[model samples]
Target chain A: MARLPPSSGPASPAPAPVACSPHGRFGPYGGRYVPETLVEPLEELTAAWLAARSDLAFQAELSDLLANYAGRPTPLYFARRWTQQAGGARVYLKREDLLHTGAHKINNCLGQALLARRMGKQRLIAETGAGQHGVATATVAALLGLECVVYMGREDMARQALNVARMRLLGAEVRGVAAGSQTLKDAINEAMRDWVTDCQRSHYLLGSALGPHPYPAMVREFHACIGREARAQILQAEGRLPAEVIACVGGGSNAIGIFSGFLADAGVRLTGVEAGGRGPQLGEHAARFAGGSPGVLQGTFSYILQDAAGQIAATHSVSAGLDYAAIGPEHAALRDEGRAEYVACGDADALAACRFLATTEGIIPALESAHAVAEARRRAPRHGADAAIIVNISGRGDKDMEILSRELGLGGAADSPVD
Target chain B: MPSDSRAHSSSPAATPAAAGFAPFFARARAAGRPALIPYITAGDPTLEASRAIALALAEAGADIIELGIPFSDPVADGPVIQRASERALRQGVTLEHVLALAAEIRRRSPVGLLLFGYVNPFLRLGWGRFAQAAAAAGVQGVLATDLIPEEAAEYRQALAQRGLEPVFLAAPTSPDARLAAIAAASRGFLYAVSRTGVTGAREQVPPGARDLVARIRRHTTLPIALGFGLSTATQVEEVGRFADGAVVGTALVAAVHAAVQRDGPGAAAPAAAKFLRSLRG
Candidate 1:
C-alpha cells in the first residue's frame, strides 16, 4: 500500500550491454554465492561460453538448430479483437507459445545442450516446475542422444501431468522431488545435488535466467531471440516501437529475454507480472517484488520470500510455473534501477484473462502467460487508443488443460476413469 | 537436557582465541597424525541427541566438530547429509536452536567447534547479531558452504570482529588465482574439496585431491583439511600423509542414521562415537 517510486527517466545511453557484470554482479544483486566446489566448474563454464560466443562455427550450428529444429522467428500477431475489447491501446502478442516445445524454454535448452556437447558432457540434468523446461530439455537431449534426467516436484508432476508424460516420452528420466515445498525450488536443489555428485560427466541445463553467475547471463542470451524478433516484427507491423512491453516473471527468463531487446528504449515502459495467488498475505502469493527481501537462494543473490529466520517461505499460485519464491537476479537489478516495474496479477484475474483470450483471440495461453495478459488488459485502457502494447506469450496452455478443466468445473467429460 | 551438572553452568566457557585452530593443528602435528574433524547436523534426531553425539565424538578424539545448521535447501550436501538436514528441520531446528546447542556443547567439550551451513540462515539472523551470538556461544569458527570469498567481505569483517575464524573452501578445480584468494581469506583452515562434487563418502579418494592440496599449499601455510568422500580409515590415513586434517561427515552421519533407524535416538551418540573411533585407527 506504500507509494511506489517514480520511474527514473532513461539514462543518456542504453544500460551497459544487458547483464555485463565483470564479476557477475547486477549492481550488487548477483554473485556466485555457491559452494567452493562449484567455483571452478562455474569459471570453466564462463570461459567456455566466452570462447563459444565468438566462434562462428558454434554460432552457425546453434542458429541452424534454432531455425530448422526449434522454429525461430516465432510470429508476432496483432490481436485486433482483444485490443478492441480492451478499448484502448493496440495489443500485439509475441507468439513464443508456438515454439516446438509449446513454450519459449526450448530456446535456452537447445543452446545449453549444444554447449554441453561441446564440453564433452555425457549426461544432462535439469529441474522444472510446470514441466515446460523439463520437456524442452528432454527434447534437446533426445535429439543430441545424450542421457537426460529431470527433477520435478511431486506436486508439480501431478498438476502438469501432460508435460511429465512428454518429458518421459522424450527419454528423460523424471525424478520426483518431495522435499521442502516440493516445487521448483526443491527440484532445483535436487538437480544441484545431482550436478555436484556428477559434475565431471554431467551438465546442469538450468532452465531459467537465475542461479549462480553465468547462468543468469547465459540463459538470457539464448532467450534474447524472442526480444530481437519481436522488436523487429513490431516495428514492421506498427511502423514504430510499442508504447509498452510486458511478460510474466517466474524465474524471469522470458521477461528478461524480451526486456533485453528494448532496455535502451526509454520511451517504452517495461512491466513484469508476478503471481499474486490470493492477496498480499505471506505464503499466498509468489510476488517476490512485493514481499521478498534481498537474500541468497539456490546460488544467486536475488529477491527471495523468506521468514524472519531466513528460511525460505513456501509460495502458492494457481499456475505452478509462477509458484517460485525467488525471481532472476537481473530482474532484481532492473527493479532496483527503476528500469522495470513489477505488478501482481492474482489467480482470478489470470484465469479470466486466459478465458477471455481463448474466446476473443482464439488463442489459449499458459496460466503463467495469462498473468501478463491480465496486466496488459488492466493497463491498456489507461493508454491512448493508438498506443501499442506487446506481450510475450511465453507458452501454450496444453499442460494446464487438466488443471483448467478442474478449476472451471469442466472435467469428467473427456475420458473414462479406466483410461 | 542431560543431568550433567557441567552443562548447567551459568557462565559458559571462555571464548576461544581468534587463532582457535592453531593449537589443534599443532597438537596433531606433534602427535604425527592428521587432525580428525567430525560433522553432524545440530538437531538430527533431537537437540539433546545432537549434543550427546558432539560430546561423544570429542571424547573419542575428534580434533574439531562441525555442527551443521539444518537448512531447507542445502545444495552442497548429498542425500546422506541432505536427509540429516531434512530430519533436523522436521524437528523444528533453526539457526537460533543451533547457536544454543553450540553453547551447550562448548560447556562440556574442549574440541574446536565450527558452525557450518548455507548463507541465508546466517544472513537472516543478520551478520552482526549472528557473529556476536556465535562468539558468546564459544564457537571457534564458521564455514558457510555457499559463501564464496568474492562475496565474503562483510561476513569476514563480522567474524573477525568477534574473534571467530572464517574458514573458506578450496576446490580441486580452482585456478591459481582463486586458490590464492581462498587461502588469503581463510582463517581457521582451508577446506580442500577432494572432488568436484557435493559432500558424501566415496570408496577411493579422487586422485585430484592430493594435487588440490598441493596447489593450496603454494598459496599459504594454513592447515589444509581434505574432505568430500572420505569415509574409511584408509582414506583418512591417505589424506593424513599430505594434508593437515581429514573431514569425515556423511559417513559418520550415515552411521548415526543407521543406528537411530535400528535402535532409536539413544543410540545416535554411541554409533557416531564408534564410527569416529574406527576412522581414528
Candidate 2:
C-alpha cells in the first residue's frame, strides 16, 4: 500500500460520516450511485421525507389530492367475456386506466410532486418514456402551480405525439434528448444531467421506481393504492385472494405496486411481465430479468440490458413506456429471492392481447398493460377454471391509438385473435 | 502484490489516499503552479490518435493526463464530453482498449496517469480484473464520475489492493459531513467541482469553488483539483492561486473535436498540445 502523504492528517477522518444518503438496499439492489453533486440534495430529500411520512398534515394533504384531484380508489372490474374466451382462469382488471390522465402514473406523480413542494423546491423536472409519466407529472405540476420540465427522447416524442401535446398543453416544457439510442434510457440520462445542474432549485421527479434509493420504495408506496384496493376488492369480488397478480414491468412501478399487497399472501403468486419487443435478442427486447445482468445504470444497481463491455445496450419495445434498459432494484431483489416470478411477452403477443382485450371486454388496454394481459392468457389455462388472475391495466390505450393502428394495419378489430 | 483478499475490509477506518497522489502533486507544487491536467477521451478519433494527443498534452506541461474511458451514457458530462464519448464508442472503444492505450502511453511518458469515466464498465470488467490491469498499465488513479463516497467502500478496497488510488469528487453542494466522508474515502486528489453542473466550459470561474476547497481542507490535506466549466489560461491561473490542480476536460475535448473537424485527424495532437500550453502560459 502507498504511504500516507505528510500534508494529509489522521489515518481516517472521523469515520465515513453516516450522514450521507442511506444504502437503501433490496438484496444488494438499491443504493445512491449518482454524482457527488446530488448527495446533499438526496440527504435533504430523505430527511424531508422522514418528516413528511409522519406528519399528519402532510398525510392529510396528500390523501386529499389523491382523492379529489387525481381520482384515486380506481375500480376493480371483472373481465368475464375476455376470461371465458381465454379459457382457464377468471380475470379481474384493476382499472388504473380510469384514473385522471388515463394512467396509473398520476398516483406517484401527485405523491412526489407534494413531497418536492414540501422540500421547498419550486421547480419539478422529470424524464419520460411513452409520455404517460410526463403527462401525469405535468398534470400534477399544473395542479400544484409548480414549474415543470420533462425530458423525452426525440424518437419517443415522434411516437407518443398525443401525450407530448398533452404535456405541453399542461404548460410544461418538453425537452427533446437525441443522445444515445434516443429512447427512455437516454431521456433519463439527460434528466439526471439537468437535475445535477440545478438540483437545489429543482426536484427530479423520477417517473418510475427504478432510480436510486427512496425512489424505488417511495414510488412503490405512492402507487400502493393499486395493491391495497385490489386486495380488498378481489376478496369481496371472488370471496378470496387472487391465484395470481400480474402487471407490466418497464421500470416495474405498476407491477411492484400491485405486488406489494399480495407479497405477504403466500397463496397469491405475483408475476411481472417484461416487454419482449421482437424476441430474446440483445437489442430486440427490454426484458431485464430475461436477458440482463446486475449493474448500475442511472442511479440504482439492478439488472440492466448492457453489452459484455458494460456499455448500456440498445432496447426496443412496441410500447414506448417499456422501452428501457433496466428494471427496478426491488424487482431484481424479488426475482432473486423467488418471491415474484418474472416473465416476458413479445411485441406481437402484447399487441394481440391489446386487441383481444378491447374486442372482448370493450376496454382498449395500453400496449404496456397488454403485456400483463398476454401473460395472463398464457398462464390462465394452468390456473384452472376456478382460479382468478388480476391484471393491472396500468393505462388506457388512447395514447397508443396511433401505434396500435399503424402496427395492426388500421382495422384491428377484425384481427385473427380478435376474430 | 496483494495476496490477501478483503484484507482492507478488516478496518472500519479507511486509509487516507492522498499518498497515491502525493508525488505527482509535489512536483506541481514545486513548479509553483497548479497541475495542468488535461482530459481526453481515449480513442476519441481512434486509439492511435489518442495516444498521440496524450503524449502531446504531457509534453506541453500536463502534470497528469486523465484518459476518459468512454461510457454509452455519461450523465455527468456536458455535450462536448458526451460527444467525445459517443465518438470514442463509435470507434469500438472499450475499457480494455483504454487500458491498452494507457500501457502504450506509459511506455513513452512518465506523466501521471488517471482513468476517468463512469464505473459500470470497470465493474463490467470485474473490479479485481480492472485493478490488476490498470496498475499493470501504469494508471495511478481512477475517478468514476458517478461513484460518490457514500457507496465506495468495496470499490476502495478493490483499488487499494492493487495500490491504485481511488479518486473521489466533492461537489460545492456537499455538506461538511459529506466532505469529511469523501476525504476519508478518497486516496488521491479530491476533484472539487467548481460548479454544481456537468463538465463543460463556461465564461467565468465559479465564485463558490474556493470556498468549497476551503471546506475540503478541513477534512484532509489531499490536493484539490477544481473541475467543471474551467477554461482559458486566465481562469486556470486564477484557480492555481487556490487549488493544487485545475482539470480541463470539456474544454480540451471540445478543442480536440474542433481541430479534428476543421483540419482532420492529423491536426488533433498538435492542436491539443497548443491548447494545453496556452492554458499553462
Worst 10 residues of 2 chain B by lDDT: B1-10
Best by lDDT: 1
Docking quality level of the chain pair in candidate 1: medium
Model 1 lDDT tens row, A1-419: 11111111122122224365877888888788888767777777787777777666777778778877887778888898988777889999988899899999999998899999999999999999999999999999999999999999999999998899999999999999988888999999999988876787899999999999899999998888888788888788888899999999999999999998898899889999999999898899999999899999999999999888788888999999899999999999899999999999999999989988999999999999999999998998888988899999999998899988877776766666665
Model 1 backbone overlap count: 0
Cα lDDT tens digits for candidate 1, B11-115 = 433555455787777778777888899999989989999999998998888888999999888888888998999899888899999999998888887678989
Worst lDDT run of 10 residues, candidate 1 chain A, spans A1-10
TM-score for each prediction? 0.92, 0.93
- Which docking band does candidate 2 fall into? medium
Error of 1 at B149 (Å): 1.5
Specify the highest-TM-score model's number.
2
Best by DockQ: 1
Runs off by more than 4 Å, candidate 1: A1-18, A414-419, B1-13
Report how closely model 1 matches the true complex, as a DockQ value: 0.74
TM-score of chain B of 2: 0.92
